[model samples]
Target: MKLPSPLYTTQYGKAYVGDSLELLDCLSDNSVNLVITSPPFALQRQKEYGNKSQEDYVDWLAVFAKKIKRVIKNDGSFVLDLGGAYEKGRPTRSLYNYKILIKFCEDLGFFLAEEFFWFNPSKLPSPIEWVNKRKIRAKDAVNTIWWFSKSEYPKADIKKVLTPYSERMKQLLKNSEKFYTPKKRPSGHDISKEFGNGNGNGGAIPPNLLQISNSESNSKYLRFCKIANIQGHPARFPRQLPEFFIKFLTDPGDVVLDIFAGSNTTGEAAEGHGRKWLAFEKEKDYLAASSFRFLENNKSDSEIQGFYGALLSEKEVEIRSKQSALIFK
Candidate 1:
């Protein structure tokens, strides 16, 4: 069967170096199975790559959300990873993400499937003014992951993203009689004996707070970047971020798209899970450096070269100068 061509297609994914909005316009309606991205945060101070200011952040993201709603299939999902930011010069936080969420639901006709919080335990303390000096607020470590669907009933299976039962939970299940007794609580909820059934086949449902460690001290990707003398994307998410959503939202061969693919973490996760994926990044250097993430998967030297050539190729790269949108801290 003949497949539609992308800018630079790989064995398991494609890379497009341009504005995500333009790329979205080129894609067919209802073609993508999932849209997962972590756009740069609207922080008080800009980082290495540029980000939208608080004044324009919501409207800018809303524009893409409107287009994404069209490209996603009826049962498709759009997973967004956004870090919390403080208002410019103020100790208070910014509600730009909430503003975008409201716009998505009210204007874009999207449903709020669920809100997931990603807690990075290894994250360092930041915003010295509040956390270290005045001591008014704690160090911010949790990022918001909004799972929006085209329709209210998007394709999802909790079983795909279930975590293994804890050792304590396992002991409790075996000794329910000794540990947990069925009883009505102060909340007037009935405690049933059926709580322990079918747990062997299924692990417990993960909570909204997903505590995935993002501590990668040294890895192949970093090693490759070092040898190649390339500056990697400063704000890269852990692969586990996308892995959870991709597994929960899509199946094998499903198409996933990452509009703001800093370091292409979403594409890497999708490819690892046997999903067809696409990535769009405006920063040429960052997109070129992100190719290092797949070095281990290349069986031969030729294969590695072929993949790198495709990403850095002049003919393959449709370069466009756009303000980079990325922030993970």
Candidate 2:
């Protein structure tokens, strides 16, 4: 399959509206530096955007996994963001996410680089029948983010994704405490004297738990969609989710891809970090509206209309040639 013409392009990224499998086949082997995406969950019920039922989810996703393995460099990574789902009419949560992880590692010959937990505090109480009405369970807010690698050592720099120091640690640095007498802790662990001082870096290594809120009401993208009478993507990953991985797993000028870019948030984040990116989306309306995230807030209506027209235009021009009766190309 030939790589289709880009529907739209920014200074740092390209967005294609079509089957990702076709677009991915056009790339050279080991060309992508990182692959990051939050695919649709295999849920009990069918979603409007699209998703297979839980029974077929793992196999459906494995097809893409094999393609990802071929295009990623030996030191590159493939990060997946999958949320837990519930079994139909049952109180138990599904293990479909784990099933996919196993398929990636054991069957596809990939390695488990690390596991991350994304905690969305603003998530509404889910499985309403089991949690709200029955009062038998708590709110489900944590999602499993599995990071897989093609080799033992993937391209990861935790320093890039470090968080700010805690208040206590910041206070210690202000006190000029360079050395603490080494001693055994109450938990029977030895403490180092350098622990009193900072690691000399501005930020500390972040834990595996990522705290992010997905709620957005006043963003420019949403505002444009409301006025244009278009629905924004129902499931949009927080910009910071892909931003963190792109910074940690890749360097400037490296290529990144999002095969299932529902709203092209991954492209926006990659562009922000000086990385070139490619985004593939199947839904045309969502892809057209996703361009809003790339435009300035002061863009006029005509500019917005032109932006949409440029993406939708398939004007045909017929030429008279000796070898052809009629041609539209």
Candidate 3:
């Protein structure tokens, strides 16, 4: 089906509603600048979100990866948030989600750039037969975010997103610099000048562990549930998760795509960060959910209280005109 043209463009830009795979097919190679998505997990356990057998799950995910590899620009990056699955009754992990996806992306000629651990402190402890039934707690967290690139070395602006060091670390580095002498130079080395003071952007680079929680019960997820007429997808990720990647990976006006647009959190985050977004959802309920969320968040003035008087009753058909009038006034 023909897709809708991009809606009104601003800092945080437009969202398209459709099937992601089909919409991706319509896009040209090297068209998108960044991609951030949390695909439904392939788990044996029943989930409110979609679930399938291992074979079906990998295959379903791989198909989208193939298209993503094609459309992503050479310098662009794709961040995938995947959670592991457990086998039935074993009380043990069976499948490694990242390992499977890494293999799939490698087969498609995408390079593994980096891996991030999203540490959700609020995660419920997983019940364990060995631990809970007999002794203690087993593994708790399940989610991981993988960074993939189309080339061996994709462009990344590391300095743009650097986090500052803690006070304790700063003191340690200061004390260590006095005794930390430079290694012996080669025979012909020109070791002339002393190094400058170590008080630059002090402390080590930020570790890959990202501490974020699921959206608050009243905000993102609740808003989505109200507009979409469906419960939030069980595996729906928080907006902050995608917001981090989009802001760090792409500049303003860059196009970001989410193939499995459950609740369209990626699109919402992209828009908030001033990037254009394209999202695909096959399920009608999902599409409605995404649209309702997008419109509610990006509502024009005509849809609000000021445009509801009797004088404007019959003139609301021209949405753009009413919006323009509201903007000018």
Candidate 4:
């Protein structure tokens, strides 16, 4: 399918500025390998980035989910990140995210592959009334991440996203025969002698819960945005979040997409991992500022200004890694 002209193009992806549903329409059926994104959450108070009220969010999202399902390959996965919200004037939590999971599976034809949770250690104390003032509830720092797939068995490899083994596990691997014994425990699971047999892969399979910090103070994207005097996306996710799923769910050269690309972090992660990517966002400033991700590191401030100026003028800019050349169309 031929897509509309993009606001800018990187070597591996195109960042389009328009309604995501419109961009999603241009994609051929079963074209994308993965769709990983954190759309605007259903929050009580509206954020600068915009969010829907809890009541209207699920139906609002289903419109796009249907198109997303059509574009994703049979073995492809849809990973959604939704933050929890509090009910208005009460300490009670909202179930909008859970409702979305049910609506997508029961109403749409998606399978609930697996559920993951993202715990941001740097997240501030929220719902000030309940957590800070009343001291009745703990800080809500976890976001529910639902992994939906068109097929029961999606294209995923945990080996690609393994976490480093702990020091105790490292020691056990080194002296399995001397320090360990094979025995059946009270839990009724028998431990075999080959339990420590990792074959020197150097990592263990990660758990469903992901612990990643969202601190972006020193990131190049933020630095460039500051230099260019453009406001960086306020709710930018850490690249690690998308990088994990991209590596786990897709092979090199496969297509990955983000329907609501904030700073185009998913696109940047896809580019680094050698995957073709597409990003769609309605905000022009955010989409244009995302071009900073593809810019050459050693570019001068004036060059950065000129590049951003061209994008603001609505000229098509193509970024090539070779000599950090900019090709205008």
The lDDT values for all models are 0.80, 0.84, 0.65, 0.92
Residue range with the least summed lDDT across 10 consecutive positions in model 4: 193-202
lDDT of 1 by residue, 1-329 (tens): 22323444445788777888888888889999999999988876778887888899989899899999998999999999889988766789989889888888888889999999999999988678888888888999999888999998999999898888888777676776777777887998875544556345457888989998888758766766666666667888899889999999999999999999878989889978989999988887787767666555333445444545555665453221122211111
Question: 1-329, model 3: which lDDT tens digit per residue?
Answer: 45555322223544444567778878888988888888777776666666667657777777888888899999999888887666666656656575565576667777888889898877765645544675554655747788999887776766556678777546545654564555558875532223345454543456688888764677644564554344655567778788878877888888888877777788778877768887766564454444334433454434433322311232211123224432212
- Per-candidate TM vs. native? 0.87, 0.90, 0.75, 0.96
TM-score of 4: 0.96
> Which segments of model 1 are wrong by more than 4 Å?
1-8, 184-192, 195-201, 297-329
Worst 10 residues of 3 by lDDT: 310-319
Q: Report RMSD (Å) for each prediction in the order shown.
A: 6.7, 6.6, 6.2, 1.5
Error of 4 at 203 (Å): 1.6
Ranking by TM-score: 4, 2, 1, 3
lDDT of 4 by residue, 205-288 (tens): 899999999988967788888888888999999999999999999999999999999899999999999999999999999999
Task: Give me the displacement of residue 283 in model 3, in angstroms.
Answer: 3.0
* C-alpha lDDT of residue 48 in model 3: 62
By lDDT, the best candidate is 4
Over 4 Å off, model 4 = 186-189, 193-201
lDDT of 2 by residue, 48-165 (tens): 8998899999999999999999999999999999999989999998999999999999999999999999999999998899889998989899999999999999999988988998
> TM-score winner among the candidates?
4
